[model samples]
Target: MLRRAPRECGSWWWDLDDVTETGLVPALGTAARMAAVLGKHALLEPSSLEWDWFERGRGGLGVHTRLGLMGSRLDDPELAEQARACRPVGHPAAEMSALLVTGPGERLDAEGEPRREPRLVELTVSPDPYGCWAEVAVHHDVWSPCDFGGEPHPAVHANNAPRLAAALRALDALLGVPGEPGEPTYFGVAEGHGLKAPELVDGLGPDLTDLL
Candidate 1:
């Protein structure tokens, strides 16, 4: 089994304010476009949608919902309706917040063999009326130059990093907007299309195995 970091190793963000219209339907449409790019590289195959609810003035109602996609795609018109239908009974004024698109993704094992992992790549999209945005985050070190133990994993990086970079590039092209690297985390930081190389001390990066 692949070891996952307690937090994201790296993440990328896209501001879709100009490219995508503000609304649930438009957000789902954007997700569909993104999923297409990611799926092409076998990064994320969206199978479910999850989100929290919040009222305008009352703030978060602490209610959450998850809808299975089954065989349906993100672009399916009914998906949005299904999501809205899951509204909490008491929170009539509640509205959906950022939607999380999660599913299985492929990663290469130590021997360079492909293995499937659930929620390998997490995608979140905000459908707020004011502005639209999306984020992609990875918790595993497959895209990193070194694993949590500070050990170099050239084979894993070579096998997986390129595919992630390609998907990010494709998403940028498809959305007509470039992706901005998200803030750095303890595990690693995003640099360009991949994780930044750690500053080695005696030819080894920081040992983060304890955190794992």
Candidate 2:
């Protein structure tokens, strides 16, 4: 199933489980599609993540590093090169285990130079066996002030809430299961206002792209 937490810093998470090997490919394909849907606003790039839950006890050791393929498709061969770059020569375990797609809100070139107006829209998706999930963060260094401490005002969520809701709805239809919200984290909130679930569509058409 798939579930989501509340929106914090315009970032939220969706979790899914019991994913089959056959189903994993399709799930990623849909993710690629949804990424494309939001591509015009931001550029999605592949990343490498190292998760060692036992390293820091409860805090744990988590490392997220952007890898390769600035604008390449999910199937691009350069992805392999990028993946190889993620792992050090003698440390295979350091290789990235999670498949991450991150879209920065700022308009920048492949060389990381600014080129356009800043939209403050960032999106990320990591599809892996651990727990498939996506995140959306908006605004600049400062995020909306909505937290458990108080109610979220409309102005606070004016920029990214609707877009996040739309993305969640799209993801729901693609996954074929309704997900539940998970525990809250500093990066993701467990409660949100004006959030809506995606309507169940009748048919699963040819929306799948980047099939493995």
Highest TM-score scorer: 1
What is candidate 1's CA lDDT for residue 22? Answer: 97
Q: What's the lDDT for candidate 1?
A: 0.90
Decoy 2 TM-score against native: 0.50
Cα RMSD of predicted structure 2: 13.0
* Residue range 1-212, candidate 2, lDDT tens digits: 11112333234455545432323344345456656655543433333222222221233235445554455665455554555465444444453334545444433322445443333444444544455665544432122224222334334345444444565555556555544444443433334532322222352211211221
Runs of candidate 2 with Cα error greater than 4 angstroms are 1-31, 40-65, 106-153, 186-188, 192-212
Q: What is the lDDT of residue 203 in candidate 2?
A: 25
Tens-digit lDDT string for candidate 1 (34-139): 8888988888999999999999988888888889999898989998888888999887878999999999999987688889999899898988998899999999
- Location of the lowest summed lDDT over 10 successive residues in candidate 2: 203-212
Whole-model lDDT values for every prediction: 0.90, 0.41
Quickly count the clashes in candidate 1: 0
